[model samples]
Target: MLKNFNWKDESGFTLVEMLIVLLVVSVLLLLTIPNIVKQSKSINDKGCDAFITMVQGQAQAYQLENNKVPSLQDLLAGGYLKGEQKKCPNGKDVQIDSSGKVTEVR
Candidate 1:
């Protein structure tokens, strides 16, 4: 069997074929990356919106307990918030209005 083996019969991709495959893969990646980024941004926006809604609920609860709207710092100090204040993934800070409306500061 070894004697019958022929080196030229062993086949694999040629340089040009390998280059074509690499080019196709590169093109696919280039097309996919932007969509992935867009999806990530959309997810972040949704997450930020949900986060604002949750914070607003917490603010409302604090208002009910204290009979006045509280600032973000006050909420944190009073143990209404569990951790450091959160910001939008788009780099906006969460803010509270006089009426306890939570929003992202542009």
Candidate 2:
């Protein structure tokens, strides 16, 4: 039976088949990449928002403890903040105002 088998007659993917598959993959990537980028931006924005909220909370706690609003440097100096300043995942920096409110600067 092995001797009778014809390997020459076995078929592989045609050039057109390969090209079609490549076209489909390319189209899928083209369609998917933009959505993925959008989703990543959205996730980063949400993460940054949460970070800003946490920083604001810390600043508020600091103000309550010290009986006055604290600047970012003061927070860092007082060990209320882990760092001198924090940069958001979206490349924005957290800003602390005189009232201890937190904002973001892109």
| TM-scores for every predicted model | 0.84, 0.78
lDDT score, candidate 2, position 39: 100
Q: Largest TM-score belongs to which candidate? A: 1
What lDDT does the true structure give each of the candidates? 0.88, 0.87
Alpha-carbon runs more than 4 Å astray in model 1: 1-5
Over the stretch 6-104, how does candidate 1's per-residue lDDT look in tens digits? 889999989999999999999999999999999999998998998888888889889999999989998898887878866776667999989788989
Q: Which stretches of candidate 2 lie over 4 Å from their true place?
A: 1-5, 83-85
Query: Could you give candidate 2's per-residue lDDT for residues 51-89 as a string of tens digits?
Result: 898889889898889899887788888887785457788
* Residue 51, model 1, lDDT: 81
Model 1 / residue 3 / CA error / Å? 4.6
TM-score of 2: 0.78
What's the lDDT of the predicted structure labeled candidate 1? 0.88
Looking at model 2, which ten-residue stretch has the lowest summed lDDT? 80-89
